[model samples]
Target: MGLLSKSRKASGDVIYNNEVKPQLVAKDGNIHIVMINSFSKLVNQNFGVESKYTEQIGSVINDLQQDGYEIVDIKFDSLKGQGITGTAEGFHTLIMYK
Candidate 1:
């Protein structure tokens, strides 16, 4: 079975692009591009020192750029929840796409 199949069987929530909706469109050079419509739900959550996390994500993107990876976009998601949600809930997710 493929990794996606296994993940689905395990009831895992997968993150595929920012948009949940899936669509395809032809781009220049006849290249097909898949688009996922999604909003930054993480931004809705409360995170102490939000700017700090944003800066951290920016730094990461900068590093990646320096490494020669063309950053298409950077999405910062503020993990929500409290002590029960784990420390990760307080962290931000830096989604980088080349």
Candidate 2:
């Protein structure tokens, strides 16, 4: 079984526990591009210092850059929650290439 399959069978969470953190998944050290998409819910829960979604994304990007990763692209999407039952949310996507 592949890493993804093993991860899925182990837990439902894909990004958090399944995928390797702090390292790019490369095949023979040939992976030159990496993409990261983070939701407000996950980011806020993970990073205790950041109180806002943008702040969380910024913190992550800063860390990655400091670690010698180059930012290739970035995108942000704002989500307006529905009715009174939904909470506002946002998505931050970062593309890094080494």
Best by TM-score: 2
Flag clash pairs in model 2.
Answer: none
TM-score, model 1 to reference: 0.36
Q: Which regions of candidate 1 fall more than 4 Å away from where they truly are?
A: 1-49, 83-94
User: Considering summed lDDT, which 10 consecutive residues are worst modelled in model 2?
Assistant: 11-20
Tens digit of per-residue lDDT, candidate 1, span 1-98: 56634543232122232231133232233423222222222344474654433343444445445544454544444344534434334544444344
Against the reference, the lDDT scores of all candidates come to 0.38, 0.46
Q: Provide the TM-score for each candidate, comma-separated.
A: 0.36, 0.45
lDDT (C-alpha) at residue 13 in model 1: 21
User: Where's the lowest-lDDT run of ten residues in candidate 1?
Assistant: 12-21
lDDT of 2 at 9: 34
RMSD of 2: 10.2
